[model samples]
Target: MFECFCCPVCGQALIRESQTLRCSAGHSFDIASGGYVNLWVTNRTHAGDSKGMVTARRRFLDSGAYGFLLNRLCSETAAFLRGRGEKDPLIVDAGCGEGYYTAGIAAYLRRQNIPATVAGVDISKAAVRAGAKRGEEVSLAVASLFKLPLCPASVDIVLSVFAPVCGAECARVLKPGGLLFIVSPGSRHLFGLKEILYDDPYENPPNTYYLPGFRQMRQFSEKREILVRGGQMNDLFAMTPYYWKTPADASARLAHLPTLSTPLDFHVDVYERCEDDAQEPPVCEHQTHNQ
Candidate 1:
């Protein structure tokens, strides 16, 4: 299922050997018991989301508060894959977090009888471990989006949902005319929750959907209101960027509320990759590391 991983140390293709992925240069990465490989070759092991944050995200997402978003994403993905006319498509979720959307999309495609190879990559080992528990259909890798372990021109579609966009690296990995799907918060997203957290809440600013070596193909927006209890509300807050920056007083407001209704607005933007000879190649070395 995961035949596209490259060596982080030597920039060579990795061949899976039982519980390890080894390269031609003798560099190897061990696959975790949870069925994920740590391709993040760095001294800092705990980089991305913390275990607490992953737990909060998993709980909040599994509560079915974002079921509508998942359904829409599946539908959109199936439609795109059908139009592509590939017998077997390769889909990569650049920052899959805990694999909620990754697993959902894979299952949805299976129901539609579309054969797809899904790969989920995240910088957090904890998040990838949690993602592995979802299923083995998605190949989980603890790798950075900026410098993916994927080979050149091998992927069909790249999905980035509420995650950082890596333009040049995406272009290097995606085949000619490949699609890049970016999902972000739409205007007025989480406004209801914001109202309770702050005295003056502002609507979310417009999102920029531009990326190098890619042209905008389509844009879609969906919104839904969901009621969440205090515990679930806390989970929601903890999973977002606001939790770290919000004042203690603002956070205390949710402690007394029995339930809170919030709007979840998401914008999906599709970009088609274009050939840019001037585009630079992906940087393989992370701060000049040696094998």
Candidate 2:
């Protein structure tokens, strides 16, 4: 489906080769065998996602700690697309770390009999590389969200889960009748872990915020109290950003605890690009909670 992608370096048309994508201006990038193309040219590396961080993320996600959240996202996204009579949609996940959620959503779409082309892009080479190793069918790319490689108005659905959102870039790449879905942690998400980690746990404000270009269409929160026993507690802590900042004493405190139950609250927000002639907002029907 991606015959030509824009060069992130110069915005030129990047010609697709069997093994490399070459732009007219001599900027060439290699396409890995696992179905990912690296297109990042900048050096602004993320400190939080080093090689060890990516590994920790993959291990934690693979352990199924976040499987419930993944399943919810898939079901809701499928329902949203079905209600709009959208089939064979092209979906992109910006800042997709390790491809856990992206791959999960792709499988869910397939089960719903929806023809889907899912692409996951991240600036971290380690994250994208790990994602590419997952398998074919899901296209992984090493590209920044600020400058997506897709052409304007080319995508049908875009997802950003606990990651940065470039509203202008999203609006540019989304088709006229496209939807943008975002999943952010609620105010009380992982409160138990926060309490153990920070000396001032109250200082960590809620992470959810609305962006500028996108108008909110629908918002829902999923809250579940999960009792994590044994090693799962460590995995839970490792999967979150708080792990990076948590003090050694806090880590020890969590490590010593045999069992910890925490509340997991996630907010799913969907937005639609406003058009000139559109009069009414998009229709959103809430589904019964599967829990």
Candidate 3:
């Protein structure tokens, strides 16, 4: 699936030899027993969600509370490929945590008998391992979004779900006219959670993305109410940014929430890479505020 991956060190093509991925330059990355590869170098900093966070997220997502969001994402992706007339597509799940959407999208294509490939990448090896548990439908890897391990112009579609977006990095790995589907949290996303944490909670601020060398193609707003029990609520809360931002007292309140209702709002924006010389002056990404 990752036959197009490159060496992070020398930028040479990586060939899978046994359980190791090596380039002609001799740079090698070992594949974990869990069916995932770690291609990240520069062990200077440890960023990304912690192992505990990954576990919590997996448990919460496995509960199917976000099933609607998952299904919508995969359906929209298939429609996007069909609309572009690309029968065989190579898709990337950027910042794929626990491989939820990664496996979901891959399985959707397989069920519809579409010829395509899906790969998942994240900076966290722990997260990649958990995601690998979903099986081999996805080529899992430990990679930084800032510098993806794939070769230039190698991928057709890139999916960024509730993850940080690196426009230049995405553009670099995508074909000249490739498509990028980014899912950002809408203003109402997790407003209920915030209401429980902050003294005066506010709606999520609109995220601003600047994608040069690309133009908006399409967008969709998805809003749903998720009802979660105490355990599920705890897992969901621990996996979010609020876990780090909320104080002890506010956190105490979550333990008492036997069942909580929250809004799951996502603004999915699609951008198409323009011809190298046809890109317009850079500007803010166009997005609708899903209330």
| Local distance difference test, candidate 3 | 0.82
Worst 10 residues of 2 by lDDT: 282-291
* lDDT top scorer: 1
Give one digit per residue, the lDDT tens place, for model 1 in 191-231: 88889888998887766743667788889888988889868
Give the clashing pairs for model 1: none
Backbone clashes, candidate 1? 0
Q: What is the lDDT of candidate 1?
A: 0.83
Please give, for residues 1-291, the per-residue lDDT of candidate 2 as tens digits: 334367788877778777788889998888876567877777775432567777877876787767888888888778767876755667898888788888888888888787778888887778887877776468778887778988877787898887776777787788776888877777778888887777666533444443444577888888788788887687677777777677788899999998887788887788886654243432222221111
Give every collision pair in model 2.
none
User: Residue-pair clashes per candidate, as listed?
Assistant: 0, 0, 0
Deviation (Å) of 164 in candidate 3: 1.1
Q: List TM-score per model, in order.
A: 0.92, 0.85, 0.92
**Deviation of model 3 at 145, angstroms:** 0.5
* Poorest lDDT segment (10 consecutive residues) of candidate 1: 282-291
Error of 3 at 148 (Å): 0.4
Stretches > 4 Å off in candidate 2 = 1-4, 12-15, 23-26, 43-48, 83-88, 203-212, 277-291
